[model samples]
Target: MSEGKKMTSSRRLQLKSLMLQIATKRLEEEKKEVAAAKEAYIIENCPPPDLSGDMAALTEFCKKLHIAIDKIDEGRYDIEAKVQKINKEVRDKQQANCFKL
Candidate 1:
């Protein structure tokens, strides 16, 4: 892996950790935006169930809620996968260096 200038495992792990944190924060922001959009869309289209008592409006709200929930879930899964992959690399690098010593 080190043909030229070599990076220590500790340095590689630090860089990967920083990258993971940035990615996680970005995903969190996106999730917040999606939640806000969901709220706005629902309020604009649907009203309180007791006040509106409209089936169509309630269904619209439900659909929008599900859409937002799905997006959030997908984002969480993506972030988790990225974390796992990075963690695996860090673990592997640590193990490789440990065995070398």
Candidate 2:
């Protein structure tokens, strides 16, 4: 069964855009919540700044943080490489078109 009233192309586009915006906002909220929870967990389990006495705990956290940061750095490099490849492909396509004219 179909509705008596059909939606126009513009209306469909508007609905899709609105849906995307709603999804993006929800994702942002979830990311913020996850970050807050992680921070809280770290504060509760990790030692305080006065680790001047228990250097062991400080050292462990440093090692853990270094590993996490290394992963982020690797991801950053991967994204940069992907972006450069995409741009090069686009430029190559454009140049190919120029040769035809």
lDDT of 2 by residue, 26-84 (tens): 99999999999999999999756555547788898788789989999999999999999
Off by over 4 Å in 2: 1-53
Error of 2 at 96 (Å): 0.2
Q: Extract clashing residue pairs from model 2.
A: none
TM-score against native, each model = 0.49, 0.49
- For model 1, where is the 10-residue window of minimal lDDT? 46-55
Off by over 4 Å in 1: 1-53
**lDDT of candidate 1 at residue 76, scale 0 to 100:** 100
